[model samples]
Target: MDDTSRIGAAPRRAGDDVIQVHARLRSMILDCTLEPGSKVTQAELSRLTDAGRTPLREALRMLQQEGLVKAELNKRITIAAFDLDKLDCTYAYRISIEAAAIRVTASLLSTAEFDELDRTLVDMGEAIERRDRDEFEGPHRRFHQMLVSHVQEGARARMAIDADWAERVRRFVMQGDQHSLARADAEHREILEACRARDGVRASRLLASHLARSAFYVAAQLEPTYDTILTRTALRMVLGDELAQTAK
Candidate 1:
């Protein structure tokens, strides 16, 4: 669906066989290269990625734990569906963690690093102007990575993966509206401005509101049958208790 497979480029070192294999397979699953609800064979993944059996097995096991790949009692392996709570939970924690990351990152960026962020923003704006999803995805992904890079490595890794997952789900729901790109441009500019001013509290609050806005928008569009936290309690937790009260 519009080359979304690359939307979430989870970072990994090239030399680590298991991590590389896992990242490749996970990207496939998230991008729908390995379509949701489809059965996947061990040999098939091995051949597709050219990874050895041991690494492939290890990668699959890890994916299973992440709830992206499911193993059945009958030795079946299936790619998880888009219609899962994994996306919900991903955003729930992502909102909180990423806000914290931005707070730390904004406070810590070097002037040179801040310039790098500006470059990505420029690239993203140009992509949106052209309405080119392919062009946008790279800088967009990089923009997010750049945002959280100043945090601890562990937190950076989680934010990268979770952000990718959240982006995928957002694409599923939003269908790549160009209008949203406009909103994103405006919001991202404000986020960077907060960073420029070195206001961690303002940056963190903006980041939280940015995520909460998306969650609320998606919730409104989902049909009644979907099992999401459009319900008050779950929504508040993700949206932040204070923001939730303010919305009312």
Candidate 2:
């Protein structure tokens, strides 16, 4: 079906409608097409997605729960801002969860799965060589996901949430420097090699360190962009305040 007809057309099932709307909205947010902290009007969203109010609202609610949208006091909903504090917390939480998941999954990976992961790493290398940012992100995510796929189902779900948060943070970081692109490629290579050796502990440690490095780099880049509330919040939290305050 055409794009217009597809968005307007209702899903075959009620449950599927919610999922489809949520996925589309989430994509817009991650890609910065909707942008952070931008107001979202139900009428406007309905027109944009060509979906009805009910499904749009349902989708917005789901995004809110996922921390991608903020439901304000006056019943207004907007795309959530990139909160450094929350992002920092998420990084910490994810490192713990994903590291554990990867460790467990390493023990369970089959020869075929290992081969697939190796291929994904190869794809990531090519994407980096060509500086294909969009292509790089897909294989980058897949490589990390493969590391944890053999874990318990529940653990994989939790890791997926972590993966989503990481992607958002990566997009933000990419806005500042191309150097991070190279660093990310190198980190993926290290992670894959560790996993291939079945060294769960080493793999987990490397993954955590890799994520921490990315978080630090992004937090550094955000210094000059901090607003008053964010500045104060960073101060109270003793995180990025000094750099933010000095930023011109």
Candidate 3:
């Protein structure tokens, strides 16, 4: 099926329609189809998503809360512009929260949770082998989510949103040599091993370093001189000064 047709296909229920529309719109923004910093009216979005005003408005409102779009004065909405500073801070927030959460969560993972994580790793490996980022994304998110499953509800919700935002920044800012898929998989394995050993400190340090390096790599691509100081600071806070310095 064509992209527009697929995105615009109506759902059976009104609530489903809103969710479908939201996912479609979010995908478009993240895929850069609705290019960053571009401005469009409600009418344009309605036609683009082939969604009615009610569902489209609801979807836009959701995206607005996620900081993916900005509602303007004349019913226009601007796609959130890509910013290096924002990207840095996003990773910083993620590093701090996930590292802290994993410290408590790692020792608590059950056999079923470990099995689920193992399956996700296998799925991620298959996706990587196929060079299918869309496929890889699901398992990747699941891997992270499962690690922090025991975290408090509010922080867990924030992590979910941050995951989407992190994916958006990676799509928008990272390219070419900035990517290290192989190393990423390796890091995932190491982190998993640490969790398996019930070594929360090791897992937390590994996760912080993994997240920090990703942010620093992306920042380097955008501006070689750009320092993701916030990310570094977060890593240090999680891993401490000596370990953080050697985390790279």
RMSD of each: 9.8, 7.9, 6.0
Per-model TM-score, in order, reads: 0.64, 0.68, 0.79
> What are the Cα lDDT values of the candidates?
0.72, 0.73, 0.85
> Which tens-of-lDDT digit does each residue in 183-236 have in candidate 2?
877787887778878888778866766776666666666664533333233332
The C-alpha stretches of model 2 lying farther than 4 A from their native spots are 1-21, 46-54, 72-76, 104-108, 125-138, 223-248
Q: How many backbone clashes does candidate 2 have?
A: 0
Residue 193, model 2, lDDT: 79
What tens-digit string does per-residue lDDT give for candidate 1 at 1-248? 57688689765434239988998888677556787789977777777887877788888899888778888776568997765455556666766787778878888889898898899999999988887655777887787787777878898887877776676555543353547777777888898899999987777766666666665555555444555463344446545688768854
Best by lDDT: 3
CA shift at 162, candidate 2, in angstroms? Answer: 2.3
- Which 10 consecutive residues of model 1 have the lowest summed lDDT? 169-178
* Candidate 1 residue pairs in clash (backbone atoms < 3 Å): none
Identify the runs in model 3 with alpha carbons over 4 angstroms from their true place.
1-16, 41-47, 52-54, 83-85, 173-179, 223-225
| Candidate 1 ranges with C-alpha deviation above 4 Å | 1-79, 173-178, 225-242
Among all windows of ten consecutive residues in candidate 2, which has the lowest summed lDDT? 230-239
Candidate 3: clashing pairs of residues:
none
Query: TM-score rank, highest first?
Result: 3, 2, 1
